[model samples]
Target: MEVYLIRHTQVAVDKSICYGQSDVPLAETFARDALALEQKLKQQINDLHSAKILSSPALRCKQLAEYLGQEIEYHPDLLELNFGQWEMQAWKDLPPEEVNPWMEDFVHLRPPGGENFVELQARTARVFDALPQLEQSPVVIIAHAGVIRSMICKAIGLPLSNAFQIEIDYGSVSKLVCRWGLWNVKFLNL
Candidate 1:
């Protein structure tokens, strides 16, 4: 099985804002970025026309998936980590006291009214577990950074605590291959 993970294009929100699962708009450069990604993806993946395309239900991801002109299967499980009360708030503006605990142990610490990194990994894992059963190879999943990171972690047998070490930039693509029940990362942040 060949899996391609694509992060959504840049969001319209400011850099300091935390908009996880907040349904934000795509940036003005979406069309240009999408076109470039499409071209690059075509060059990288053979049989692109027959590959199965999946995406998060979030508008940011949906926009890019649609722009790619593929029939997209939207999955809510592919959404970014739920930031809860931090959604749409600037990270710098968040209460340091409230943020400290999560920062100290993000993998296990649930933010105030939010899910922990472990929860995010579980949902992403579920989505990945179903991929091999799908009737397609070179499966493309368009989703958020967190979702892609979690998938990479799961693929490489890396602990969720080290997820931040994998950089999933907006509009970037990562590839993975599964064979005989073992996973191998092809490349990342392409």
Candidate 2:
């Protein structure tokens, strides 16, 4: 399978804050970024006749995926990390005395009333396993940075603890091609 893992465009939020799974709106800059994203995808795929599009159910992702002007599957598993009660709060604003411990061990740390990275990996794995054969075409997934990061870690043999070291930027594209038991990372954090 040739998976084009995509991170959704920027949201309208403070850059210094954490906005995980908070149902935030997309930034106004998205209109321009969407056009560029469309063009970028065209450059890579060249022809969309054989491409399959899937996306996170998050409103921001759905809104950006509309640029494809084609049918898209909404998969709940592709969502960003669930921050629970921490949603929408500036990381720095939160009591570091309380938040630092969790941030230090991000992969295993579950937010208050939320799931940990282990749970996230399981959910994303479901979506990852469903990826179809890509030799016949390409598969495009519009999801969160964390989703893309986790997939990359799984495909490239990186430990979950090191997943965050892979900086998947918003509106960026990451690619992996699977053949037999091996997955070739075509691009990372693109």
Candidate 3:
């Protein structure tokens, strides 16, 4: 099975805002970005037209999934990591005391009323576990950078602590292949 993990396009939020799991809107360049992404996918995947599309329920992801003109299935597991009270808060304005602990141990530390990376990893693992049963061919998942990075980590057998090492830029696509329970990364941040 081949999986195409796509991150959402630029969001409408301010640059420093922490908007995990928030239903943010896409930027004005959505149409242009979506078109470029669609063309890129067509060029990379031969059977893109027949691929199954799954997306997070967040508007940022749904907009692109809809724009792609495919029958998309929404999955809550695909949502970005919940930032809880930190939602919409400017990252630079957050107190160092409040943010430092999480920065020191992000994989295990949960924000005030938010989930940690371990929880995000668990949910994303479930999504990957179900993929083989859901489809035999290519599968495209439109989701957040966190979710895409989590998938990449799982596919490549990297530790959750190294999640940040895999950069999933907005509107970027990463490809993974699974064969008989073994996983391999086809490409990253394409």
Candidate 4:
């Protein structure tokens, strides 16, 4: 299976805000960014519209996926880590006591009402593990940086704690190939 994981375009929210799993608007550059991404996919795949399109229900991701093809499958497992009560709060404004613990070990510690990285990884794995059943030549997943990183970690056997090191930029595309139940990362943040 050829999996292309594409992060959504820039969001309208401020950089300081914590917006995991929150519905956010796309930035002003959405159209331009989406167009460029479409062209990029077209180069790799013969029919952009025919490739199986899966995306998180988030508006940011949905917009990009719709731009690529009208037939899209939305899955909750593709969503970013749920930030719980910190949905729209500024990162600086979060209570230090609560943030400190999670900052130290976010893989296991939950942010008040949010889930940990392990949960995110498990959900993401479910979607990826099922890819073989679809028997599709190419699969396009439009999701967040966190989701992409989780998939990368699983693909490369990297630890969840090191996920941040992958650097998944907005509107970036990462490719992975799966064969005989083994996964290999082809490229990242393209």
Tens digit per residue, CA lDDT, model 4, 1-190: 8999999999999999999999999999999999888888888888877789999999999989888887899999999999999999999999999999998999999988889999999999999888889966799999999999999998889999999999999988899998888899988888
lDDT of each: 0.89, 0.82, 0.89, 0.92
User: Of the pair 1 and 4, which is ahead by TM-score?
Assistant: 4
| Top candidate, metric lDDT | 4
Q: What is the TM-score of each candidate against the true structure?
A: 0.97, 0.93, 0.96, 0.97
Worst 10 residues of 3 by lDDT: 128-137
What range of 10 consecutive residues in model 2 has the weakest lDDT sum? 128-137
- List per-candidate RMSD values in Å: 1.0, 1.7, 1.1, 0.9
Can you write out model 2's per-residue Cα lDDT over 115-170, one digit (the tens) per residue? 77778888999988767533444888999988888888888878888988888888
lDDT of 3 by residue, 112-181 (tens): 8999999999998898888889744789999988888888888878998999988888899889888898
Off by over 4 Å in 4: none
Model 1 C-alpha lDDT per residue in residues 127-179, reported as the tens digit of each score: 89998899888899999988998998888889988999889998999999999
Against the true structure, candidate 3 reaches a TM-score of 0.96
Who is ahead in lDDT, 1 or 4?
A: 4
Q: Cα deviation in Å at residue 146, candidate 3?
A: 0.7
Question: Model 2 misses residue 90 by how many Å?
Answer: 1.6
Q: Let me know the TM-score candidate 1 reaches against the reference structure.
A: 0.97
> 166, model 1: CA deviation in Å?
0.7
